[model samples]
Target: MRVAYNEQMNALSKILGEMAGLAGSAMERATQSLLQADLSLAESVITEYDQIAALSHQAEERAFALLALQAPVAGDLRSVVSGIQIVADVDRMGALALHVAKIARRRHPNHALPEEVNGYFAEMGRIAVALGAAAQEVLISRDPERALRLREEDEAMDDLHRHLFTVLMDRNWSHGVAAAVDVTLLGRFYERFADHAVEVGRRVVFLVTGTLPSDEDHEIDLAHGR
Candidate 1:
């Protein structure tokens, strides 16, 4: 029974790795399409949503299957639970990519705005790609310390998110309504993607420590000066 449980977990990890890769590619392409105003890639991102969602559901079922069939306990139980979390986070990341694509489609022909805002969007994409890679690494290794460090990177993305919003709100900057709305949604996509990655990192910590720590005990505080 123990052997079978381990086998199921091993298979699950492989399937999840594929999902992570597809999701990462989706985000990367979505970002590129938005920045370049390439409608084709944006459309591709929208079309891939079904596969991403399917993989997430499959992951959930496999995790629950392991729980029901193997009655996993202790560390093993943690693995199953964390598997569910990892996939759900991955799926949310995929959704953010889709949202980015939608924003990209809406802002077409008008072009991206503020000139300087382009740099912010570029950095947001960079951080998002990095977040996707880090999430994959956490699932691959299940290392709590690595995951903790990954979560810390979210602070930088958050800073960019807020800065872009401030630029959007500036009365002097004339992006017009359509462009401003696109910028706002773009910022939101990056912020939410990073947040989902952080959630995966929190689950990684839980898997390693065998205890899911409450948010109340988290002591790391950001200066919020950005």
Candidate 2:
């Protein structure tokens, strides 16, 4: 049964890896849709989210069942429990990706955002991709320190996001209310994407330390304009 339990844990790891990959892809596709006004790609990512969620649910259930049946102790238990925590991160990441897709779909019919904002959107996509990649590395290596480093990279996205608002909120700027709303939502989507990335980093910390962080642990990254 020990061998069986070990095998189950390995399978869980594989599932989590796939989940992260899908989430990363979803975010990439969403960004392309937003940057290029590709409604079809946006719609596809949104529609595929159900599958992502389903896979996540399955991973959670398996992790729980392993706990209940195998009653893993010591390192085994830590591995199983940490795997569960990672699944939660993956699920949230998937949701963040789908959220971006929704914003893209809504902004369809309009041309892609102005050239000034495209680079920021691309930067956001880079962060989202990094977040998933970081999570996967943490899971595979159980390197909490590496995951913490990845968390710090989220600040880059936040800085870019702030710069975007600064450009849009200038007194002389006149993108109009509708365009402004779209831009605001796009910024929000990117910010939340980083937020989810931070959450994944927190999960990694939890997995390593076996302790969850408090709300006070978060450092606000909002721009001065807000």
Candidate 3:
């Protein structure tokens, strides 16, 4: 029975990893759709989000089922509880990706980003993708060391988000209110996406070390504009 329970726990981890990959792919394609103004890509992203949602639900169910049937304790209990929380984060990431794609589709044939600030958004997209990949690695390896590194990676995303606001606040900005709103929301999406990735990393650290992150760490997580 213990062996079977361990196998189920391993299976839960595998499903979580797969969900991470799906969310990451969604964000990458959403970025392409935004930068390139590809309606087809955007449409595909919107259509495929149901799968992410479904998988999230499946993972949650497995977690609860294990809790009730196996009555997991100690580290096993933590794994099951943390798995639920991480899946929520991953699901939200997918929803944010869908928002990006919707923006692209809404503005079809015309790039969502203005030419002047295109480079900034492109870089933001890259960082978001990289962060997503890092989150996946933490889940797969369960390495607290790698998890610690995600905080530094998150700083880059935070810096970019701040820079985006500076551009919006610039007096010489020629883009109209509508464009400004789009850029503001886009920056937010990427910023929040990275935050969720960092949150997942923190969860991994907790699962591995059986120690909660410092209060300072929680503050850092909340400081970034959610």
Candidate 4:
């Protein structure tokens, strides 16, 4: 019974890793579409999001099955519970990517970003993709230290997000209010995508360490701009 339970747990972890990879890929393509105004790529990201959602559902079902039959305790129980939360984080990551693609499609035939601010978004997309990949690695490796490092990557994303607002708020800005609004929303999408990736890492840390990072620790991180 213990052998069977461990196999099921490992299978759940594999599914989560696959979901993370898909989420990362979705963001990559969405970024390309956003940068290049490629309607076809944007459309693909939008349509293929169902695949990620389906995987989330499958993972949730498996987790609940383990809980019901295995009666997992201690670390086993933590793994099952963490798997459920991780599923939500990964699903949200995919949804955030879908939003990025939708913005690209909405502006069809025209670039969503102004030329001056395009570099900011290009870097934001790169960081968001890297964070997603790191989240996947942590999930597979179950390394709490590696998972904790996601915070540093998330800080880089926060820095870019802050810098983007600075550009939008500049007195010399000439992109007009409509373009400003689009950029504002796009910046948020990337920031939130990175945030969710960080959340996945936190969940993995909890799964491995059996201790969730305290709210105070989280507050300290935020207070320090981590």
lDDT of each: 0.79, 0.77, 0.86, 0.89
Best-fitting candidate, measured by lDDT? 4
lDDT by residue (138-172, candidate 2, tens digit) is: 66666777867765787787777778788788875
The runs of at least 3 residues in candidate 3 whose Cα sits more than 4 Å from the true structure, single-residue gaps closed, are 215-226
Question: Candidate 4 — what's its lDDT?
Answer: 0.89
User: Worst lDDT window (10 residues) for model 2?
Assistant: 214-223
lDDT tens readout by residue for model 4, 1-226? 7998999999999999999999999999999999999999999999999999999999999999999999989998999999999999999999999999999999989998999988988999999899999999999999999998898878888887877787888887898998888898888888888888888888988988888864322212222222
TM-scores of the candidates are 0.90, 0.87, 0.94, 0.94
Candidate 4 Cα outliers beyond 4 Å, as residue runs: 215-226
State how far residue 112 of model 2 sits from its true place (Å).
5.4
For residues 112-206, write the lDDT of model 1, one tens digit per residue.
54576889988888988888888887777888888887667888887777677667677766868867766766777788888877787788789
Tell me how far candidate 1 lies from the true structure as C-alpha RMSD in angstroms. 3.0
Cα RMSD to native, each candidate?
3.0, 2.4, 2.7, 2.9
lDDT tens digits, residue span 26-132, model 3: 99999999989999999999999999899998899989888888998888888888999999988988999999999999998888889888888888889888888
